[model samples]
Target: MRTPAAALTGVVALAFADASIVALALPAIYGRFDTTIVGVSWVLTGYAVAVAVAAVTLIAVRRWLPTGPLTMGGLALFAAGSTWCGVAGSLGGLLAGRVVQGIGAAALLSGALELLSAHVGRERGRRLWSGAATAGLAVGPALGGALTEAFDWRVIFIAQVPVALLALVVLALSRAPALEPESGEPTTNPLWATAGYVSLFAGLVGALFLGVLLLVEIWRFSPLAAACVMMALPAGTIAAGRLTATAAPAVRVVGGTLALCAGLVGLALLPSASLAWAAAALFLCGAGSGVVARVLSPAAVPTSAPLVRSGGAVVAAKHAGLVLGLVVIAPLLAGSLTSGAEQAVVTGTGVLLDARMPVQEKLSLALSVRDTFAEAPRGAVPDLAAAVDTTNRSEATTAVVKEVDHRLSAVLTRAFRPAFLAAAALALLTVLAAFAVRKTPIGYPRWRAAPTAILAVLVLAGPALVAAEVAGGALDHGRYQETDPCAAPADPYPGDGVDALVQRVAYGALHGAACELGLSRERFLLALAGQPGFAGVEWDPSTVERTVRAAADRALDDVQQRGDLPGWTITLVRAAVRSMPLEELLRVVGLR
Candidate 1:
């Protein structure tokens, strides 16, 4: 790479990084700007929307302008936008800055390509730009998280000012490169390639956007800690570059899509609030997305079409998908999480009431939790230091507090399940598009559509299974309104005896099941215990059928009511619940 191309590459990385760099900083901005997740999201989408519109619309504009002048001007405007964002007093003002930066970024991206092509070969220039952009997307959030932790979120924009200026300085000092004339009538876009970009970026929302929020808001990790965990993304992305180099295009797309889907599924079903689990899942996402981006991006740009117009298609498709993901997924995520948060607190109330603590301590602790939640920012799990604050520390009180917080985190993690799965499904669409550009595995040239059909089903199955469990969106405002026993218990008790813990979980599950059934816990337990073969050595399917219906009817009812679906629509639900190996579960619930 020549000095000018290298300089432009640096800025291209920064500009694309600018797209997602604000992601980790959003939680801080959330409270600071008094915005919800939906509102704060415009900070991200605004830039992307601007970039998408400008990247395409400016194609005609770029045709007339000299690359040298255009790129220098773009660097200056980018600096101006950064300074504006740094100093903005309101979210609206900051958004305006984002728009400015986005337009400038479009110019930068366009001009960078021209300069690179002039200095390096056309093919090499496109490769460098694509790699830098992909790397930028992967690196942005982690770097933003680090910056936000070290200083204020506003400092992030201030920090970019120097980078853009340094790039401008390099370009100024280097030799001016000549712009290449548009050689082909690149009138039309590659449909499959564009679709691939759309699906790929839309799915990435699960990994980059929601993943960071889970770490900072729900897990109560600091921005720096979240950044450290997110480092797995870039590591895996870089690693996948090497791993997929020899793989065929179709294999890269299908395999990458599968990996991406699996990672998201892993996220949806995360076992605990362990950073290791998150990092592992994100690694899969990173590698998968990296493979997809590298293969699909060049495929979108046709060999015959003008590189600028085709580049515009790729840019427009990607950022538009981001905008699309934010528009669709953000609302879904916000709605589900809001109600889920309230439900979590209501569910935790059961643990509080069930603990062996005295009434006075329970009341005191309840009040403290209520106050903390009432004061917490939207979409954030409150720090509950004072939740167990008392003149004297009682073991039962302390235990209950720990369990409730644990439950909150667990439920919050579950709240994101739908969004993650949605993202995975969206990414899966790219595999269908990838088939349009499929090159068989190196040694498997005769592989036909049968394998493609099977791959499609395999890719589609996971999200379909998870989506079957979809209930309605969460309650309004996610506020902990009152005592409710509806959440399912899944976490192991920390430092708890197995027998004692199992007994507690059994009762908790029974209690929640009974609440759904509109029966008292005692009543539900007695009903199961009275059934024939209750606690029997022989598992009786006949009596089990009776017992299963007794317990499952209420659950199916709730599912129907919540989803506004009719009884017959849930035949699968009936089959699944009817087939559950609930003998053990019922026995545990039946324990005295």
Candidate 2:
């Protein structure tokens, strides 16, 4: 009995570990596949969705499948899926492999629990299962990080193959009993259990998903460093386990939910990318999750039902929550990040245009800075200093650029706060759901009344906190106003020809228009270079600047000759010079 229990525990640990082991590796996967965050999120989502679907199906047919064969078959499938994931060449292929892994994981989870219940009774089995899963959750991120850093993300999955095989061997040698259905009415309510499970996982999405992204993408930590930081979550869980072991289910649920909510709120209010702040938040999350699991697991699936069915239901609910959380949060996060980047570019460009420098030098500096911003990887904060040409720039100019860099970094950091707030909102919902868990019969009404009042306070307090922060200007939503560079006093030029006028306007208007359009100068130029009649045009800095000046010259010449050109003619010319290549502008003016 002991040997079989130990073996099954190992299998359970692996299955749970796989759920989050890949989180720290997500950025690496995104880079490797050249995929969007939403696309890359499908890696985690696909696995979770597969697990939920398969677990449900397995539960429906629990009475027909024998525990021994089910466990062995799951191990085989898990091994195969791991192999496929390790060798997958594309995002689509990797997603397919993850689904296979999810299916196998569901089977193993349900079957192992069923076998344990048959061998040692439901009470002992639940304790062992929870402990094993907690152990896996604790180690997954760190192990995944070490493997991803030392080798590659693929190794994380590949390493799972041997562990699955060993579990299979152990199961075979133990001769575990077949699953059997229970006869009595279930003590726990399935609806309450499902709700609790879903809310628990949904709240965790912020810590596991957004936290990892912030560490790896925005903060620019190596995968190993991110993993090391994430270890706080599991460590908290382990510490809370002993403390919550004898607590009433209701007390544990509420306490855990409160801790998780506090953690998420802390993340939302993060002043900077300080590891100390993140660690404190993650510890709360981990500890809360541990307590929730300890109190909620047995209740999640009624002991009156077949052990396999009950276990399947619980697993399905939890993974489904993960899928749901990602689906909702990923889009919000992506949109916030896009808006933040645009804001940064606009703000940074304004700083450059207003800087005290020679016009020609400013133009050169702007081009260099734009190029630097363009070179930064997606979802990463641009390094402003790296974008400047220090060799030719004055100390004053460099100092200005450094200030712009600081502002850009601040904007980027502020962007992710909304996502964290959204996560905190989700955690608050978990707290509400946890209040629905059945209380002990001894003080049922009195216990329920106090928590009900507390739940209301939490519900109101969460949004209030978010609102206060936003109202305090933690999230800036100001729009960029396009400046009219051609307005008012005209600059005195040595030459009165069309070329000189065009040069003045082009230099004056380009930065303002680009800011209005939320584009870096480099991006705006490259876009123009790609327009009609500009095919095969060289995009070197000098070439792009010359082309813009020439295009402005042609547009001005055309409007002047027409004499009756509308008041908006100059506006059209400016737009053309900003968007169209010089050749395209000449063709539009009938001068090609």
Candidate 3:
């Protein structure tokens, strides 16, 4: 006899997989939609929001509805959404389809979890789904990356249709017993409960959004490397999930929530700290998020009629968190930059919030000082000398330059810290909300929601956080270069194919470029080589020389095309300068 139990597991796994599949498709989505940084996030936010609502409302939705029809209906909606997304010509249409898909995802997600919880013993079920969801979560990104690399992004959704249909066939073939629906009003009314879940979700999502953006944008990280670091969230969640049964339920929920808050605080406050410390904090926060998801699972369920409603609520709460993370946090972080501006404005309206400003800039004189510094390099004189002329002060430009640089640094630091502190406060608030996740009854059947929720929190958050940074230009759009090894070779020369030769010629050029541009060549190269196309490609002389020259050319064309330095990446500029010269550098950097 075909069993219903394994089918439920497959369904939940698929749901978890779908949630992550979008992460790798983000760059492609942006290419088609051409949406702004904040706007593009809604593609994710829309899906999450719809899913969150569906999870909470599905209990009532499925009350009169049979599982067969319910599953089919959801699958149909999902298929329709997938089709819409696949062929969407505009951002709006894509977003709408994403929302539809999210709704379908929520239905499938919660429905499958409910069925599994009812059919299997709770603890065993929780462990099984927990492991399955975690596996799916982990696999989603890798799958998405591979699919995105191998085929058009539309194929991802199109491919899902068969899976959904297969799931339906399994359901039709199985003779699963229908559980009696819980009859009575829920402890938490559906509407208010959903709102609360949405609110909490928003805070968590916001914390992630702000944390990651600050890490990469303000701090600067490469996309692939940032993604690697963000994996700490899933790692933390897994660790927390493992500890949940061991710890007192109340303690796990409360402590996890508190950790979640602390993570946000660390993310906001500890940007300048070592990457390990920051990642650790993110892991803790993710663990707390997992704890919160697990804790809420039982409450969102009832051991009676309308069972699906409870399961739906749990899923809704989980996805709501995701929606809030992306949509709310991104704008808040962007707004924080304005907060710095507001502070400057409060000091005096004359000050501007120029993202293009050099790292050194006082509120009062940042522009003039930055101008002086830039001009200094052009004049072959000390920046301080140039500052005098720009400031029109009697003191030597060098002296004024030092004073300005010092003052500018102080102002920028002050302005930036407040935003970080604010982000920390929001994280702390999220931690508090996590505590609101009620502890499960002692020996209560382990809810599938717990682990699935935790997995979602960890894995989904990792990609979202990374995406937030990429969209914000924190990590440069996958660009890098090497230094020239030859003694001022007039032409970019070829090199031998030995590892040391490649290192000496190409890596050396990268290092030189980094030094000249005052950037970390090692870090930048490390970042670039980390991308999918470049990963493990190796540092060969021919490859390095070609790549270095290409990168330099790309950098100059980038500057000219975009009318600005690409991510202010000096290494790319230097590589271009070494490969060609001032005119070529300008032409390449300015390539439109």
RMSD vs true structure, all candidates? 13.9, 8.2, 18.3
**lDDT string, candidate 1, 63-165, tens digits:** 7877777888888999999999999999999999999998888878877776777778666777788888889988999999999999989999999899889
In order, candidate lDDTs are 0.72, 0.72, 0.52
Q: State residue 390's C-alpha deviation in candidate 2, in Å.
A: 4.0
Model 3 lDDT per residue over 430-453, tens place: 334333334444345444555545
Q: lDDT of candidate 2 vs native? A: 0.72
TM-score of 3: 0.55
Deviating ranges (above 4 Å) for candidate 2: 118-121, 177-186, 354-362, 377-402, 441-592
How well is each residue in 1-592 modelled by candidate 2, as lDDT tens digits? Answer: 5877877888898887887889889988988887887999898899989999999999788778988898889889989999999999999999999999999999999888878877777777876886787778567777888899999999999999998898888888876555555566655566676677776787787788888888888777888999889999888888775555555567667777877787777666655557876776788788778877776766665567667777888888888878878887888888888877766676676676556666667778878876776677755666667756787779988898887776676666667777777766776666554554555422122334444444344334444544554565544433344344333123422245565554445543454334433454434544453522223445565664564464455445444444424658767766756687667755764546
